[model samples]
Target: MKKDIHIPVVEDVYIAIVNEYNAIYKTQDWNAYIINNKAVDLELVLIVTSGYSKKKATSVFRKKLDKLPKQSYAKIELMQEELFALNNTFKVTFFEGNQMFDKTYLFRENTINLKALQSIPLMAVKGVLAK
Candidate 1:
């Protein structure tokens, strides 16, 4: 008789937050905040995608975090134009212990709070602006 091997899946170890940052100069930017809620460190890769056509999707941004400590978070920023053009979706892949995990989040999902983004602090400018 042949036996089947099974692996357990972990749930809710990481959380993602999407928000908008209004710059001091009247410009706006979008940000994705990845928070690790697990007790151990993690290695993560973040990919942003958007619908390119009726049947196809395209990647707009890619970032990798070699190590995200437990209970820590990382912020990834995007320009307003890019966020609007890309339609704002995220695919996050991470490694915890010996297992790998992956999940996708859409902009319209309830997990992402767009209204809270407005309360985020604005980006500060350190240099003078040119006319």
Candidate 2:
């Protein structure tokens, strides 16, 4: 059942395990195929909720669960999507899993670099003419 698998989503982050081997390992299975990354017939099936930018999602293991409304689910339709949502989602897992589950490491200062999406104006200026 889909509900058996817990997918965590925050804001615009969306992630999923695509490579069959990684997916198996992620779901807590220790199969040989996953142990050695030996799956040669698998394709990446990353699904995400809308609002995720293409550049921010890029990772093989981490994924974002797309923002689902209260008591609801998300709908994914794009076929050739990018990986930004996945990367952002993975970053969260990386931080959370380290802080809560792994008790081997100590706390340290974490710094983040914020990046803003850029856009160019396409329409002609009203007062200035191109020379």
- List lDDT for all candidates, in order: 0.51, 0.22
Q: Write the per-residue lDDT of candidate 1 for residues 71-101, one digit (tens) a residue.
A: 6667755434333433356667778887787
The TM-score values for the models, in the order shown, are: 0.57, 0.15
Off by over 4 Å in 2: 12-93, 98-131
Tell me the lDDT of model 1 at 87. Answer: 36
Error of 1 at 64 (Å): 0.9
**How would you encode candidate 2's per-residue C-alpha lDDT over 24-105 as one tens digit per residue?**
3354211100100111211222322222344443223323332223222222222222322331221222123222111111
After TM-score superposition, the amount by which residue 61's alpha carbon in candidate 2 deviates from its true location, in angstroms, is 14
lDDT of 1: 0.51
